[model samples]
Target: MAYAIIETGGKQLKVEPGRFYDVELLHEEEDAAISIDQVLLVSDGSTVTVGRPLVEGAVVEATVMQHRRDKKIIVYKMQPKKKTRKKQGHRQELTRLMINSISVGGKALATA
Candidate 1:
């Protein structure tokens, strides 16, 4: 199997074609196409390519499946002696991305 490491939303992730991953929210509409060029490493089964900072001409293409929010979590705080209490709930915005292809030098090496 071929895989590549990409950086997005201030984090690095291992990505492959035909797989879906939930990443930090992207400002694109559902079914929109996006290309990520911050490839750090690519393993094409037989050879590996590591970039100095980012691989030149390397890109990972994906489609935005949906925009959703993560499961909510509760936060609670209490002041035992003062009889003060606080409670909060939070949810993180996320986007579901389906990897479509990985390419180098404008030639796709893997596809969904």
Candidate 2:
């Protein structure tokens, strides 16, 4: 099995080709291709490459699937005896991406 660890949207994600992942909102149109260069590590079952902060010449290709928001979360605050209550809800914007390939040194390692 081959996999790569990529950093995006201030978070690290373990990604594999052919899989879909939901990440923080990105400023790109749906169906657009994106290249992620902040690869921390890559493994191909037998060999592994690690980076100091980020790997050189390593990239992950992905396609923007969609843009959406997460489910609402409710926040409630109450002050007993004071008769004070506050309620709020929140939904986080997100984007869906489909992993297309993993490459290193301009050589493709895996493709979906």
Assess each prediction's global lDDT (C-alpha) against the native: 0.95, 0.96
lDDT of 1 by residue, 1-112 (tens): 8899999888899999999999999999999999999999988889999999999999999999999999999999999999899999999999999999999999998999
Clashing pairs in 2: none
TM-score: model 2 vs. ground truth: 0.96
Screening candidate 1 with a backbone cut-off below 3 angstroms (N, C-alpha, C), the clashing residue pairs are none
Q: Write the per-residue lDDT of candidate 2 for residues 5-108, one digit (tens) a residue.
A: 99999999999999999999999999999999999999877999999988899999999999999999999999999999999999999999999999999999
The estimated TM-scores of all candidates read: 0.93, 0.96
- Evaluate model 1: give its TM-score: 0.93
Model 1 residue 50 CA deviation in Å: 1.4
Candidate 1 residue 88 Cα shift, in angstroms, is: 1.1
Predictions: Cα RMSD each: 1.2, 0.8
Question: Largest TM-score belongs to which candidate?
Answer: 2
Worst 10 residues of 1 by lDDT: 41-50
Which prediction has the highest lDDT against the true structure?
Answer: 2
